[model samples]
Target: MYQYDLIDKEFLADRSAEFRGQVARRLSGELTEDQFKPLRLMNGLYLQLHAYMLRVAIPYGSLNSTQARRLAQIARDFDKGYGHFTTRQNIQFNWIKLKDAPEILDKLAEVDLHAIQTSGNCIRNTTSDPYAGATAEEVDDPRVWSEVIRQWSTLHPEFSFLPRKFKIAITASAKDRTAAKVHDIGLMLRKGRDGTLGFEVIVGGGQGRTPYVGPTINEFLPTDRLLSYLEAVLRVYNRHGRRDNIYKARIKILVAALGAEEFARQVDEEWAKIDAARADLPTAELARIRAAFAKTPFETLPARSDAFETAKANDAAFARFVRNNVKPHKQPGYAIVEVSLKAQEQTPGDASAQQLEVVADLAERFSLNDLRVTHAQNLVLPHVKLDDLPTVFATLQASNLATPNIDLVSDIIACPGLDYCALANARAIPVAQDIARQFADLDRAEKVGELKIKISGCINACGHHHVAHIGILGVDKKGEEFYQLSLGGSGAEDASIGKILGPALPADKVATAVDQLVGAYLNVRNDGERFLDTYRRVGLEPFKEAVYAQAD
Candidate 1:
């Protein structure tokens, strides 16, 4: 993880002091709610339907044990006893008090964490593959570049307030764990024919009311010129992006209005004017950032762990957990363990203070003090030793974190919808909880196999329903909550937007509708076919017919 230098520390202190003064003024009646809206938003504070919500950025989803402990402390002291991990790999404390906002920021700064750019129309946290340095599949650690983007984008004078909020995700692996296709700028690190590293740049991808899979603006951009190219792209958007209408303010909208070819042409023209030498990072600075993410020290060991194998053989519960939560790691004797926050009938992406502390302790004791927050709203102990699997699993089980459902039907991704957000139309968390409870049976859930069900409260798509295999979008039908279902969406290497199935069903019918879709999939699926594969092969008609037929 990148450690904060004196300059970084000083900057945060200044920002915290400024916000403290702002909050005091607001509380003193000098500033109205409308007057303080933008100021609060700039600090990642939102006045939700119930109370204030504070979002804390976890850059590239990286967190040290110390930082994780600090987050748990904040959950316990300032807000509720839990925090919600978001789709962007950030954490949100939903039940925050406005008076404590500045104090929370100060606490976060102590651990080199902050909530800046987590809201408002600026580049949000630059996310990357959660298994960045731990996986062998990636060309290099994508976090190195993500950190570079963070430093460059944070409080940049020129692009501070764009048409709308922008997001960037990078991945070095061909598997696309970062959902690169659904970001404002998706950078895929790859080696060229000459063996020089560069990026395949995808632009204009986003999900909201108007969803788009960003087009490839540049097929190959050298690593050295990343900043210059990004600058060019943003400059084009800043100059020509829609600002008159809030609905069509995103860069994706601009990219859509102008054809991809014309957009590429304008970016190229803009790139020619900027001096690459001035815009790009110096060689020394790049090396410094790369050094911060250097490989973790590991003991020499054989490929297989006898203890791990024995534990799996002896304990059926442990075996199930290994099959679901344990992922392959680059190190010979280590495994990447995903701790699911979506326990049965609980809110997705939420962790209690005790659960967070347990994870922090586990990371410190067994995983070299390194932790990662996945875009799927789960935690990753990226370097747990194979021999420590039993201990880790036992601790997680005790903490209620061991929900053997990674990428399973019950492992849902849902946003804090009408439960908290002022922008929401209907409740997403309840729908998600109901569906999770419906599929709580492990045998049945495992039988369903590798299904991703994402739910969004409204058209903003914060829950990323546009790219889920089975998407549920909550809507209001004459003041009653209803859900519109979509199928075959994926946020992966094979990125595609899901098509809507039929009319919206009432909230009560959603879980049943999802069950019908799953049953239809199981009936028609060929040998070894997952839900997505079956859906792709059979198309939407079969599943749509099954869901609506049952509803009727």
Candidate 2:
């Protein structure tokens, strides 16, 4: 993990002190709610339906054990006993009190973490692959660039207030675990034929009321010109992006209005005028940042571990967990273990204070004191020894973090929805909970195979429902809550927008309809095909017919 430099520490401390004063003013009536709204939002505070929500940035989804422990402390001492991890690879405390807000910020500063840029119209947290350095297919670690961009954009005066919120996600892996296509700016690190590293810049991708897969603006941008080219792209959007209508304010809208070719030409024209040498990082600084993320030490060993094999042979439950939760790592004898936060009937992406502490302890023991937060709402111990799998599994089980449902339907991604969010038109957590109960059987979920069910309370698409294998969006129809369904959406390398099945169904029928969709896939699926593969092969008619056939 990148340690905060002296300047970074001073910046956060100063920001925290300033927020403390702002909070005092708000509480003393010196600042009205209207006056404080933008100020609070700049600091990642939101006034939700029930209470204030505080989102804290976990840069590039990377955290050390110490930082993890601090998050656990925040959950225990400040808000409710748990916090929800968001699809943006950030965490939210949903019940923060106005009085305690500054204190929480100050505490977060102690651990080199803060809520800066977590909300507001400014560039939000930069995210990357959870398996970045550990994965085999990456040409370069995306975190190095993510951190560089993080430093550059933290408080850039030029682009502070864009037309809308901006997001950047980077991925170096062959598979797109970070949903690169659904972000405002997506950077894929790659190596050229000559073996020089660079980025493939994709722009104007986003999901909300409208969803789009960002088109490639530059097929291959030299690594040294990354920041300069990015500045050029942002300059184009910042100048032309709409402000009259908030709905049409995002860069995606601008990109859509102007065809991709014209958009690329504008960015190229802008890039041609700027001096890349001035915008690019110096060689020494780049080396320093890259050194900060060098691969951790690993002992030379055989690809497979005898103890791990023996344990898998002995315990069927452990074997099942290994099959579902453990992933292959770049190192020969290491594995990446995913700690599923979506326990049965629990809110997806939520972890109790105790559960956080348990993960911190486990990471310290088996993962080089480092952990990662996945966009899928799970935690990863990225460097666990294969032999430690059994002990880690047991510890996770004790803490209610080992559900063995990594990519299953029950491992849902749901937003705070109507339960806590004022923007929500209907409840999302309840629907997620109902679906989890409907598919509680582990055997049944495994049979379903790699199903992704994402739910959002509204069209904001915070839950990323647009890219799930099965998507549920809640809407208010004549003051009654109803849910809409979409199928065959995927967030992988071959990203595709899910197509809506039909008209919305009552909230009560959502679980049954999902069951029907699953059954329909099962009935038609060929041997060894997952729900998504089968859906792509068979199309939506079969599933749509099954879901609406019993509609009253």
Candidate 3:
């Protein structure tokens, strides 16, 4: 929804042109693979197992239909027929050619999109709640702060090339949909004592080798001082974070070693030295940014849509979809419609070029020309008219994008795994596909209710397996693929790392083990309890027993 200003357009043009020259030199033998590695990474290009991968950043998960159409075009022409939407709310093209990379970047720049800061040891995409402006629960739109951080952190001289890659997620809602706690820096927007807006800053939250939920560094950092506080935290991490061991290089490790109190003290000391006014955004700039995100022209209507209710009452499928895929909007007669990419037996987040185009068209027609990418690998038409639900559903159904399995077991989150990523030890997509096929019954999936199954190829936790209700990690055992399961994990406000159930199961046995675990949950769950609620209430013993019993 935020239009690119002249400066923004100029910056992208300049950056794209510069990258084009760099790419030309690399392709012409002036730069070897080793020489081009860092350069390519800086621009979000990765040489995967089969081909080069290009990750394009969708800032704070917001994009216009024009941008969406451009992405579809890129998926159609440049790389493959589809693009993978990631947990970071970014898009990854798996079959990118090194030679076509520059042209792709240029094309992205045309639509005010690029892969800048999508990779390397800098602040990655600053994500926020997808329902930012649409949700009524938020204190303020987190995208306002997210954009501020994005503009400030992009190519900042002091924080570039940290000990490890840094991530920052912000959310204003009481419900933490952004997985804020798993980021290197998590900014929870809140109102202070006098009703003034501020951030409850959490530092050192990460989920890789050593999973950690960032502890609260500042109980209340005033809105104006956000940048200054963030600077102080980054400065502290940069000064003392591990450099000798890449595994221990993340800020989370530093925070754990030093303790939260000491980390907070250090950040405070650093904050005291810096001139806050100099680092903080000016009022004019803040106002300008806020103005860009002003509310859309939502019509004044009654509390409920008669047409929507009538359709829901008439059609079972529509009713089921309404129950699962449609979310309440802050505006009356409007809905936040989730376009699920996780269809039965499909790769979780893979959207075909045609599917992308269809979504773009739908967004332009129904969602005020704005679309949002959720952290859960789903797309959101954040402001769809309730009366248009049937038409929207029919269009999506035709395109195979209307999957009513949000937060269900079959609605899995999975990484590229051995299929595309070089770091992966096992194939995650096939495993996810198997599980989805096993539980293809929509009624059965809805009965299971709100189960998040996240899969990762390796411990890198790209799929955010660390925070799923049911976490699966793929490991290589003597050249054979094995799947390890974890339980009681969540990425919500009550964020927690999953606990391992038992030994890793063989690849072929994973689906059976998952079924057994689900059965155990159903057996032990209380009335109206979801999988996570049941897991939290009963602990992992029941599920573990059920799984191991099947093995025995």
Clashes of 3: 0
Q: Tens digit of lDDT per residue, candidate 1, span 27-146?
A: 999999999999999999999998999999999999999999999999999877999999999999999998999999999998899999999999999889999888999998999999
Candidate 1 local distance difference test against the native: 0.94
lDDT of 2 by residue, 1-552 (tens): 788999999999999999999999999999999999999999999999989999999999998988899999999999788999998889999999999999999999999999999998888999899998898989989999999999889999988999999999999988989999888999998889999988888898888899998899888999899988989989999999998999999999999999889999999999999986788888899999999889587778789899999999999989999999999999999999999999987999999999999999998989988899999999999999998889999999888888999999899999999999999998999999999999999999999998999999999999899998999999999999999999988877788899999999998899999999999999999999989999999899999889877774
Against the hidden reference, what TM-scores do the models get? 0.99, 0.99, 0.99
| lDDT for 225 (candidate 3) | 92
Root-mean-square deviation per candidate: 0.8, 0.9, 0.9
Report the number of the highest-lDDT candidate: 1
Please report, in order, the local distance difference test score of every candidate based on alpha carbons.
Answer: 0.94, 0.92, 0.92
Q: How many backbone clashes can be found in candidate 2? A: 0
Q: Any runs in candidate 2 off by more than 4 Å, and if so which?
A: none
If both were scored by lDDT, which would come out higher, candidate 1 or candidate 2? Answer: 1
Judging by lDDT, tell me the better candidate of 1 and 3.
1
